[model samples]
Target: MSAFADDTAKDEWKFTLKNAYINRNFENENLKDTGSWSQAASLFYNSRMVDTPLTITDKPLKIGVDASVQYAVRLSSDKHVADTVLPFDRETQSQAPDYLKHGATLKLGYDKTLLSVGELWLDLPVTAVDASRQLLTSYWGTNLKSQLTDQLYAEIGRVEKVSPRNAEDFQKFSFTSNGKTEYSDGLNYIDLRYQVMPSLKAEYYFGNMQDLYNKHYLGLDHSFNTENFTLGSKFKYFNAKEDGNNFNIDAQNIGLLETLKVNNHTFGLGYQQIIGESAYPLPDGFLPETYFINWNATGFFKKDEKSYHFIYGYNFKDYIPGFNAAVKYVYGDSFKTADGKENNESESNIILNYAFQQPFLKGLALQYIRIDYNVEHGNDFGEDRLFVNYTKRF
Candidate 1:
């Protein structure tokens, strides 16, 4: 909550504060209440690395030093609704919810690109933060992002360490799943996007999880207007296979979504397929990362499975200019056991979001969500999430 700048410099000093409150209850009458608060400070300065005018970025010589801290607050709440929500394990609370630094980044910018070295943050679909959690995920490594042209862009990086959203300490990056697997030296990733037309674009992503797996993703998206209606369609294909000496993981995933938007109303339909002998793995832990965003409550990825969902969204912008809401219902079928038995599951989610447009609260936002899951074998549950955030640039 403080700052200082050089007397003769144009550098901008920045600070940020965020807070969120979460309450989750289960079908078994289990209730938990918690809150997370975060703060950050940084100095964006000029670097003399290149004396030439900018050719690729906003400034010819820009550098920055940024750091962030966070705290997790566990509120006193009853967890005896029915007590079946989850087994309480004192051994699991190995670390106290204390004040801790989550991010520290050294950034350099030139031309139209910027590179960051040291601890950083990622928000990709597969290796991203679990926003429902109290804190954000942080990674340690180097990243380079550049705007190559008006219609093209690229991001490349190598991250060897990670401090998950809910973890107290950093851990070596690796693929985490239902089974314990050896950690790797981290992961490598690159993403490229090209605008094929004014309203159509394509994106490709690549990731190598050390010797465990390598993943490839290709997606195409397009949106256009017809009269007062907006129509959009998105398609993505994914491939993950064993890499190096690893032979226990392999999978193929496909996703398709179509949407129609009119005024403040929007409708969407989505389909996803999972093919292969093994389930696809995303990073996980108390501080996990996952992205195969096909459903409201789960990834819906199972051996020989196909999933579908429909979504409805409304934006009060036309009515209130800063409010929006959405709901989605998802179903998964054709799950197969090793012997090929049939299993099924269903999920649904309700969400509401709003951002304040008033001058004093211009950067404030609030969101609420609920997700329900029903599976065979008499297992059914629901999760509720609430988030409040505020951000600003100075």
Candidate 2:
């Protein structure tokens, strides 16, 4: 950037490069004792796509380009299994490692508004896919976001293609793992957030996933800060219905979470209820719309299920900066499955995270997550995961 910058120019266009790598170790105690340890790298080139060399423009608008390629290499001791190391070396759950994760993107922006079209990253709750494994899930579509006012913001988007975090190549919208059907309607969304007061804020989101399903979400957040601690509360509700043939499902989910943070210690309690449906109609879609404090393992959304979670966290910043730990326990019951029998389940999760503050590794992070799920009737399993992540920008 320093080499391309010139104060004399009206608008400056700079080219840059960045890269990220992740080493993941995923172990399962109940799934045939199989584990997969893999390492993946994504190289990003932030440059224009045009082949011809063009002069830089100095104007009020800023134009940029981005492209990325990701490759995954499984460890020598490979235990080939389903759902082992996702988005990496797997034929059933994801694409094999040979298919590289690649995409090209273009951006046009100025001031507080921006327009993006191409293969891009959209992390919206129900719209965003995962990158937890070796590669990230990117969407093919267009988006527009702008700050309408000092207290209000709006975003609108239409995503036509999806390459899931655990899959290679783009596919159409579907509720199945292998997407053999494509939808021309695609997915559309509109979201808005407003700051009602210094201590209160509200957000609304609406999405239509072509002929599959659609959802409406409303949320409110309120927080209070005192000399000793801070208190926060969130309330969210969502209603979903099938559009055409959504596997015959319609559901409503409501959630509430309250947290109290005092220095290094924090505690939280959350509750979520799933009403109606054949599992919320989001099994194979994007992330669920649940705001539960303990969103781990299975979503715990059955035909008629109620879930409760307890959480505790601590930030060891005083002793070690950029270090934190948290644990949560969740239980779900009062569920009616296909057999008309009551089902019950429980889950426990623990995670430890550390972010590097050292100058040489400022953007590096390490995390360990362990989750245990117990079902009264269905399958029971436990997972242990370790992640080493790094990111940087110059």
Best by TM-score: 2
Task: Evaluate residue 39 in candidate 1 and report its C-alpha lDDT on the 0 to 100 scale.
Answer: 30
Tens digits of per-residue lDDT, candidate 1, 1-394, equal: 0011112334443444445444444455443432222232222222223233434444345556666665544333433322211113355532233335456677676656778898767766456755555556677889888888888988999988877655656788666555566677878999899999999999999988888788898889999888899999888888888777645777898888889999889999989888887776665554332445453446678777798879999998878878899999988888865565677888888889999999999778888888788876334776666667776655
Record all residue pairs in model 2 with backbone atoms less than 3 Å apart, i.e. clashing: 10-58, 11-58, 11-59
Clashes of 2: 3
Error of 1 at 123 (Å): 3.6
Alpha carbon lDDT at 188, candidate 1: 93
- In the range 1-394, model 2's lDDT, one tens digit per residue, is 2112222333222222222232323234454454456676667666432222333353345556667776666553534554434443435433244336678777665445666788877756576556444566788888887887889888899988887665667777676413434353588899999999999999998888888778888889999999999999999888888778634657888888999999899999999888975566563434443344346667776767899989999999999999999999999999865677788999888889999999997778888888788877776766777778777554
Report lDDT (CA) for all predictions.
0.67, 0.69
| Model 1: pairs clashing at backbone N, Cα or C within 3 Å | 56-111, 56-112, 57-111, 57-112, 317-321
RMSD of each: 5.7, 5.5
- Model 1: per-residue Cα lDDT at residue 203: 91
Sequence-dependent TM-score of model 1: 0.81
Any runs in candidate 2 off by more than 4 Å, and if so which?
1-35, 45-61, 76-78, 87-99, 177-185, 283-293
Candidate 1 runs further than 4 Å off: 1-24, 28-61, 77-95, 286-295, 318-321, 337-341
